[model samples]
Target: MEEVQTQRESEQETSDESAQSDQDDNQPIVSPPTQPEPSYPSERLKRAAHMLFFKRGRVPGAKAWELKAGIGKSYEKVLDQLDEELKELDLQVKKVEAGGIGEYSPEDDEADKFRYFVRLRGTLTPKEARMSGWRIDNLAALAAALSLVVSKQGKVERKELEIMIAEKAGRWRTLTLTDTFLRTGYLEEDETGMISLGWRTKAEVDLPSLMMLVAEAKPQDDDAEAPATSSMEESVPQPSEEQSTE
Candidate 1:
């Protein structure tokens, strides 16, 4: 009886061990903890970012010294550091000259300097547009005006644009929309008063995507013909019964 009891106890222990082994096998495996990302730059860099990203009026960006007091320090280094932080989001702070490289004159005491501007890794995607704090209407107007400019192959006559907008939203809205585009640096007026695509359009707006969108746009239905046909019918006096009989 002792031998039989001992064997039973041994078997029970084995079963318990097997059960624990199975529980361990059923448990989920845990991965190692990931390292945290580095922190953003100082308040001055943050301020620069705010101005570059949020301020649409100041295209290309503001002066480095104007951003903060520490002009002597490595401003470029700080901008590069900020760009590294923004890299995760596919954005960067690019240093742009005010009016092209030729415009930079060391001879002049007050010549234009490099300005820091915010740009995406790729073209200005809809995601960037939404993130840039632009209103829906603003974007729509831009798209419309840009489409016209693109269709014209770079420039659209101001008079033609005014007429087009006047037909839809009246003359006042045309002025407002055009002025807004101009102010935002998306449109530039040439000496001839023609509205052309601005420098920022090239910098920010994706030309390829713009062309593709314009190409894929659905054509408006031929409702003009319907209006014309109805007007012609009304203008043609109907034949009277006596005239018809004759």
Candidate 2:
């Protein structure tokens, strides 16, 4: 009886050990903790500045999507940084609607509808403004084009535009400069040859301020400025006495 009892005790001990072994085997594996990604590189701001200041393609500046793809999803943060830096240099980073001029809401930034530009932070002196590479006639043509479009409530037929610019800039110069404006995005031309303000104009110009200055301008003897001023003054709408009272 003692031998049988001892053998049973040993068998019970082995069964207990086997159960513990199965429990150990069934335990879930735990991995080491993963770390989060590091902060973006510091050079992203520099990359953003280069992208903004240079015209590398069909347009003057970079699309928001392009900057996001090349830099990061937080590319606007870098742009904000760039804008701050530009303040000292009298320049700024501006984003405008890509296709046409309208009410610009930065709330739409996530949708890739914006293009960024670097432009003067304040108005340039006339001498400094003339230093820009465009010819005097071309600049006059653009001013006239914008004025005519605004006069017509944001659109004008291409022929009407050509004629208006021609009145100031001459016919041969008008055609060439109008094409340049369309190509460079100061004005947009559709398949129907209807003209309207473009992304560049929206980004760089404040039309209401422009109209006000034109309306207030005294005619100058300088031929280039005179034509642009007179044409703009004629086209710019005036506030009626009733609206002014209000």
Candidate 3:
């Protein structure tokens, strides 16, 4: 009778275990709570803006590698985001060594070799340029210089360029400003004394639009009241801007 009692108790415990197992099987699983993804892009973008807009060290722009280190993986997307943000402010992000980048993705495996900058989306009005401390003679000299270089297939003798700019500006001013451009990275001079567009110019200037504007610019017809249209404004591939009469 004691042996029967032991067997009965063991059977009862087994039945209880089976019921508990069924209960556990029906219970819902509760996983650990997950953390939200961090939004680092906005903060990274601010860093990028400061790097591009402000002069750091000896340069006015930042390199892809520098930006990548500070912005994280595939930082070009952050630049794209910056570009979008800039459009509203009449500015845009540009990358040098990216010829015709508008038609395709300018970023590449060798992107680190390129540099990034911020530039005006629209041509600055004459008043704006002047108020920004731009002398008309200097502006004319620059327009003449870049236009001559572009017309010469992007390579010209240094002396020839100086002479071309001298036609717009005096010889002394030409020498002074040429050095300025060279030091500032707008024009590069090789050992052979050939002048070509520098990395900074490639980053900031639109060669095609510049050339077109120079080619199309002519003296306005003798009708002051005839609504003199600005060829510079028209040639530039942007929205029309009202001309500023100085």
Instruction: Name the regions of candidate 1 deviating beyond 4 angstroms.
Output: 1-60, 63-78, 88-91, 95-97, 100-114, 119-138, 151-153, 167-172, 223-246
Worst 10 residues of 3 by lDDT: 98-107
- Tens-digit lDDT string for candidate 3 (131-217): 988687887787788888888888999999998888678877889989978876778888899998877678777888888888789
Report model 2's TM-score to 2 decimal places.
0.64
List, residue by residue over 9-127, the lDDT tens digit for candidate 2: 99999999999999999999989899974445568887888888788966677888889998988898788878887899999998787646442456666557778899888986767
- C-alpha lDDT of residue 246 in model 3: 22
Q: How many clashing pairs per prediction, in order?
A: 0, 0, 0
- State each model's CA lDDT, in order: 0.72, 0.82, 0.79
Q: Weakest 10 consecutive residues, lDDT, candidate 1?
A: 100-109
Prediction RMSDs, each to the true structure = 9.7, 16.5, 14.0
lDDT of 3 at 117: 86
- Where model 3 places Cα greater than 4 Å from the true spot, the runs are 1-40, 98-109, 219-246
Give the higher-TM-score candidate: 1 or 3: 3
Better of 2 and 3 by lDDT: 2
Across residues 70-166, which tens digit of lDDT does each residue of candidate 1 receive?
4324566667778887989989776655543223466543423656678887656777768889766667767778878888987889988777756
- Model 2 gets an lDDT of 0.82
Clashing pairs in 1: none
